[model samples]
Target: MQTSTMRKARYLLLAFSSVILTTGLGGCSVSSILKKGQAEQKISVVPQVLEVNGENVLFEVKAQIPKELIQKKPVYSIDLVYNYGPKMVEPIGKMRFSTGEFIYENDKPTITRQYSFKYTPEKSRGKLLATPHVAKVNKAGKRGKTTEIASGVITTSKLVVKSNTVSLAPDDYRKGVSEPQTLTFFFDEGQAKLRDYLGTNMGVLKELIESNYKTTLVEITAGHSPEDADSKEFRLPLRRAQALEKYYKHELDVKSYTNSSKSVKFRVMPVVRNWDRFLKQVQLSALSPDQINEILTIVNSNVSFKEKERQLAKLDSYEYLQLYVYPTLRYADVRITYEIPQKKDSEIYLLSKKIVENRIDSDKLTEEELRYSATLTPLLSEKLKIYQAAAENTMKWQAFNNLGVTYIQLAQQALKPEIREKLLKEAIINLTYASHRNPTAQLFYNLGSAHHIQGNYLEALRSYDYAIKLGGRVEMLQQVFADKAALEIEIGQLDDAVTSLAYAAPGYQTLMNKALLYTLKGNYQDSKTFYEEALALKPNDALAHYCLAVIAARTNQENDLALHLRKATQLEKNLTAKAIDDPEFRAYVKTPVFREAVK
Candidate 1:
């Protein structure tokens, strides 16, 4: 009985141990399942460094999740953000994968997406981060680990050239000025003789000659009444013109005005069958519009001049025309063009300088002279001072416009941001004032440039459009289009840029922009060609050389890359740091030669 009891105890102990072991094994299995569910993911970003194209920062992201990472009821997604500054983050975009849509059983779950965000200067030094999450349907997701996918934006596209067009006021400082004087003499119908009463009209001509004003030309236009049959001979008008010429010569000789008339050129224009003068006089008379139109219709008809005259004679208003207009037409219209002396350029320039320096009265130089003086100096500071003085003294729109443009030019040359800003502000103020006075194409164009430099892109574009709307000289319009195209390139309007450039004149800026366009389009050969052409125009152009270096780096021409980079750095030392940070030379950055060349 004791042996049987001991056997039952042994069997109960063995069964209890087996149950505990089975429970431990089941717990291990659950822990293994949980570990498998939380597998690690791989995320990759193309252009590991972000790039700014036009006005936007652009990049791409790809995520790979292991199979079984997402359970039947769970969804997978990634949230992206651009961290530029402390407490500053820009939301990029999100990518989500639902359980049913992605089959983890067949293959690893993979997703690739493109992302972009508007770029700002503050966001240039930034990183792009992506965080993954797993969630149940219709519930908050558990956040996975966040990872940085891209860094530091490339802002090479923002280096577009700013070509501002400035407007300068014209000066009335001509070396020689021409003045015209008119003298009229009337004659009877069919007669070509100088009347005694006509001599009175020569007094003004005599005074003009006596004043020592050089008589450059003496033009006599003689007309005869068409009603007289002798007028149709065409000799009558010539004879009338000769009579005036003879009288003019007699006056020149008798009055001893021969010195001023020595070089005078006499031209006799006769009106015989032509009805233009008669019609013009008739139109100015108290005739009705209907009568004028009737006369115009006959005169403009495809008929003989005599036939038109016959038709005119049939009109009811013919009698009035013969009395009022015909007599006026049958007279010598003598026009004497004379030259008036003007100060030499050197003298005018000296007077302008004296006026600016307060050495002479401001009235010594005209308002135009004050404004034009700014253009004679090569120094921008001098120009600025002159324009300011002109604006203050003249209070003219042209002076203000020139002053504003000068301010803009000075701002462009300023090295300090604060100074540039101050100058640009002054420029805007003066330009705005000028616009209120009288808006011109040049003023609007300079305004656009100021706005462009200030980063007011929309306002700049509007100003540029306004400049285009206000038409100007062909050269000025071409410059405007070229500058507008440069702005378009900075904003990612490549197609629009191409169209804008079509109307641009061929110049250094236009060629450089074309090269930049070709570079963006991946036409490296054409881009290189254009860069070469641009360099030819401006041999020491640092930007053009740097662009060539970029092309060389892209094309894997190591020697050319080093050559251009060296040239660029020699011309502009700032390019050395730029090249070191530029991704265009990323592949060569690790190489010893690149380091040596950059150094």
Candidate 2:
């Protein structure tokens, strides 16, 4: 009985030990499953580095979760954030997966997502991170450790040079002005003779020739009355023209004027049987429209000239024509064109200087004269002073507009920020005032430039749009479009920028921006072509060489990359550090060629 009881106790102890061992094994199996799920999770980012498009930073991420993890937890979530500068973070996007929503029959769950966020200067250097969360159904989830998927934002698109279109008001300043004087002499019917009293009419012509001014041309047109019977022979008009020419030579002593250095050119046109002058005089008479049309119809008919005149004389308006028009047609018409002397450029400049200095009355020079004198000198300071005087004295829109444009030009040459800012501010004020007064396309274009330089991008865009809407000269609009395209590229409107650039004039900036657009689109071939064109226009452009180097590195042309990088660094020393930090060159950062070129 004692032996049987000891054997039963041993059996009972063995059964309890087996139960404890089996429970511990199950616990170990559960821990192993969790560890395997954690180890199998995979995340990948395309491009590996974020890039800016238009006005936003964009990127793509693909997450692969193990089936084991999905099976253990009914819900999965991934949170994306862009972290930059001193712990600042921007939540870009989020992705969620649930067991009921997604099927995982025979494959691991994979999710790919694209993310974007508004790009600011602060976010230029930043990293994109992703955090995974696993949760049980109807329970709070546990968050996984955050990992960085992408580093740094590539902002090559922002390198586009800003094009400012400035406009200056035109000036009506001429070196010499032309003054014309007309003299008329009347003769009796059928008489191609000069009247004695008509000699007085030649006084003004002689006075002009005798004066210091030049007589450039003298034209005499002599015609005979259509009623004359000898009009057909056409000798009467010739005789009349000769009579006037003779009187001009003898009575007016025109030969002396022709012999002088300030000589005059004389042309005599004779009108015979031709009814042009008679018809013109008739049209100017007190005749009715019907009478005028009747006369024109008769004159334009396919009949002999005399027959047409006979038909015109048979009309009821014939009496009015003979009394009022025939006398005027039977005379000589003289027109003298002379040049009025003008002040020299130096004299105008001195007068403008005196006006600006308050040494002389502003009224001494006309408003246009003052504006024109500003252009006589190549100095911007002198122009500024002249324009200021014109603006203050006249308060004209042209003066104000020109002054604003000058301010913008000065701002471009200013090296100090404060001075540039002040000049730009003044430009804006003056442009705004001018725009309100005139609202011209040129004024709006100038306003856009002022705003662009001051870093007021939205305002600049608004002004540019206004300038385009209010159409200007073709050249001005082309420049406006180019400038608008540059702004569009900076704001992330790639397609719109392309369209804008189509109408833009081709230049270094325009071509360079086109190259940049192609680079953003991954068309390296087209990008390289445009970059080459732009470099041809401005070979010393360091930024252009650096851009070419970036393309060479991306295409794996190590030799070209080294060559371009060397040139870029030599031209702009600061670009060496830039290339080293650039993500486009990340793949070649440690290579000897890259290191040597940058060095």
Candidate 3:
């Protein structure tokens, strides 16, 4: 009975298969296999990757999985990989699909996934390539080999950085009255013509003559040593003075007159005596006190200038006097006076802005204007642009130096390490160029800042020393010393820091920096004094109050400490967190007062 039933079932199954094949072959439709041109696939991304905000690169992938495949419930996975050059030290960023928790809806029948990944460049400016790999999942919940669905090239443009250029103080902006610059020309024993040694002095005089001034007063004073006081020799000194005056009027093209005139004044005074000078030399020498007194008595007596000189020469110390004292006495003193026209504060401010803006024509703006403009602008970016423009326009050392300084400022502001390194290199190039063009104190000072930023402490110190030696504008000098002091403090060179800070101006920031340096050196008393001084300059300074609080806490001044800490926290709320971890308040950390203040 069982065998008969099995044969019947087999016959029935065969009949069923035969009927289905016949129907399918006869053009009946089936939903299991995907038809040609039925499946749709597309990959697209807006913006690729250029101009990505922050670190994220967002892309949308849209596709329509064929309805036939949807019936099979096919699963797909998308993977993204970032190509950063040939080698990547680490992955750029992570990527995430919109959602994969829910099943693909047959009604919807679309494979839509919003893909996102964070991107970071290896350099300041570099290419970033992102490729998306897509694969289908088998029934076993395992992913098959992936095929690159889409790819994009993300580019990063160069990033640069800077601080604002600060304007000069009101007093510094105004030009003060010019004091007379004197140039002395020494003659070689009766020789009145120009000497090889006098060329430098003469050139200086020429420069003064050519400078723009309201008016120039040329005062020539003729002086001769006691030896040349006689009628024949006395006239030679006046003749020599006249010769120099002639050189000034003719060779240097200086406007002047032979005698006292509206612009120039020529004074021919009596020949000067060296008797008093001779007495001083004798006193300083190894000569006995008695001998020196005797020489002075003879020199100071009421005698003719020539007679006094003869008596002084008769002394044992006369040889030293002949070489040192006499040569200095026989010289023509040329005093040139000119008035530096005072500029209004507004004018300087405008000029400085113009220079930084590079709005003024190159032909119209002077080098001084460009240099001063670099110092006066309040915005660092503007300052950098202006210095670059000025350097190109003027091709001067001052412009180059200012440009280097601007680069250093930019480096300070840069967010990326690679970008900062590039900016510092640019600074070094400009600074070296500046030194070659004209090694000004300001140039060395800027170089110092660059070196310091790069961790070249020794080079920074050398540059700072050179800057101080060169002696730039007083304001720049102050800033340079202040910066030097800051470096010294960083290196634990406390005494040097003190010396360096001594040269800085007595400003609020400078005082605060000094206080910090002293505090680092464990001189709480000195630090307290400087912090108080800083507060006097800037009453509402949060940093000043914060530092004072630290000092007060260290010194066991509990009441003052609480007062200042509260004030600091009130002024700047961020200080509360910093104070919580600061070791300076270690003594007070366990106290309720400290906890309350920080909390």
Candidate 4:
């Protein structure tokens, strides 16, 4: 059942990779990669030559044949081994042998030769050496029997010596060369010896065990192999490797997005070698009802990035998401204190975000494997040194945004208004396009804050309004209420200010103003109580202190008026201006203490 599901996953993965490169402005490119085509191999090496000049005879020669040969530089070498038969030799220069052009400019035959000379008969022999050509007898047999002479094979003129074709295989490669992935999983070939696999992949298993305790990270894993246990053994290895990858994902229960809510999807790359096995495993020959159900369940479970984006995009509240992909390595046997760096984790977060946001994005990645990108390119740090360079380079757009946002937030929190304003402006410019192009509530809210700080009230209001429209959660509503109310009060729209501030908490400065409203209505007792309450919460409420003094004087409360008058004077030193100008404080306008304080 698992095998059948894995086969389907591989088909889907291949299909995604083959999706033609299409641009938002342009249609699919001329070279639309067909999902149907297989992963064609490149020229692994070129023909080489080797020589062990010992005897007059050449014996064996070996060539580095291509597992899957494409366009390669046609080149061959003549390996001449002394005292050996003629053999072919593969060429070697700087370790790698091929130039990747099949047609060889220099067509030459590899030749090896051998020569033997007898001094007496079979027992008595003279040693002979081999040269570029056929070995020739320098001396005749000394005994009555003429000296028996042996020769070697010679090429046209390309120096064909005796063939002792012994291939010099490079240092032993990893056990599984085709799949150079760091994450590897082993099985009992076809058995479910869970304990054995757990013991074998000690590190993965240990990590998996620890993951059981961490609920934040939702892990998903699928199982696959090059071959099927129930079927032939040829493709089981690939299946096994995929199965392990899936297992870790499943055991870890990785959270699929920033919200840490949904389950991570499990997928497989079964019989990754060919599509025939891929198809058969997904759609097996007629099976029993239960068997078919199990197969379907597994097959239907795998999810793709584009598919995930589509699914998650359906949520109206979910404006943005991030995907994080990482390849972590662990030594099962060794104990090491290695920590995944903050920068690395940040990268994962950004990558994950891109994956989640890929729905709106036109360009989609095929597989999780990153390309080596050998084409001439500048180092990443160098490329990011300037804005122009960063703009010119598009590959690391996601990375740049990640770092940019972190810096932008830091700038806003800076003590220097100039620095804060500069960063906030840049942040708004960058994030405006980011959220506008893709649309995220968080980015919009930040833009609103920046604009508001820079005194672009209307623009700030617009941004805040849109951000709220995009995201209508309670927390988001709070920001809008606070900003709008403060702005209204600043512009002296006291009526609107009172209405807006109704939603604000009493602990705010608006409470002092609210107390004055009661005093304006000629409610002396209420004003006195409210001012006292405001002072109790914030003893340095200067406006409240001054208001209390005026209310006391109007009520003819000698002790209260004197105390509050002195208190307000101490708190505001500038209270004289308010007492003389404010109509509500007119009664205290000529108090001797107030006059002396002002003088």
Clashing residue pairs in candidate 2 (N, C-alpha, C atoms within 3 angstroms): 54-491, 54-492, 55-491, 55-492
Off by over 4 Å in 1: 1-39, 46-49, 67-77, 85-88, 94-113, 132-146, 168-396, 399-403, 406-410, 413-426, 429-433
Instruction: Please give the TM-score that candidate 3 achieves against the real structure.
Output: 0.39
TM-score of each: 0.55, 0.53, 0.39, 0.29
Q: Relative to the true structure, how large is the alpha-carbon lDDT of every model? A: 0.73, 0.75, 0.57, 0.37
Kindly provide the TM-score of model 1 when superposed on the true structure, using C-alpha atoms.
Answer: 0.55
The Cα error of candidate 1 at residue 16, in Å, is: 17
Ranking by TM-score: 1, 2, 3, 4
Clash count, one per candidate? 0, 4, 7, 76
- Give the higher-TM-score candidate: 1 or 3: 1
**Tens digits of per-residue lDDT for model 3 on 1-599?**
99999999999999988887545423222321222112343333444333332234555654444332332232332333444446742233322222443234555345445655544434212333332222233333332232344333222110100111222112211255667756666667655665534112454454445544444467777555555432236467677788887776664333422222344554544344445433443443333457667777887789886677778778765653564345545667777766644545466557656655667665444444545555665888877776787677656555666678778778878999999999989887877666544434555666777887775667777877666544445666677777777676655566877766766656865677777776655788998898888788788878788877877876789988888998899889998866765546756878988877766
lDDT-superior candidate, 2 or 3: 2
- Model 4, span 210-283: residue lDDT tens: 42222223222223222233224444434444445454555444522222223333334343223232224223
Candidates 1 and 4 compared by TM-score, better number: 1
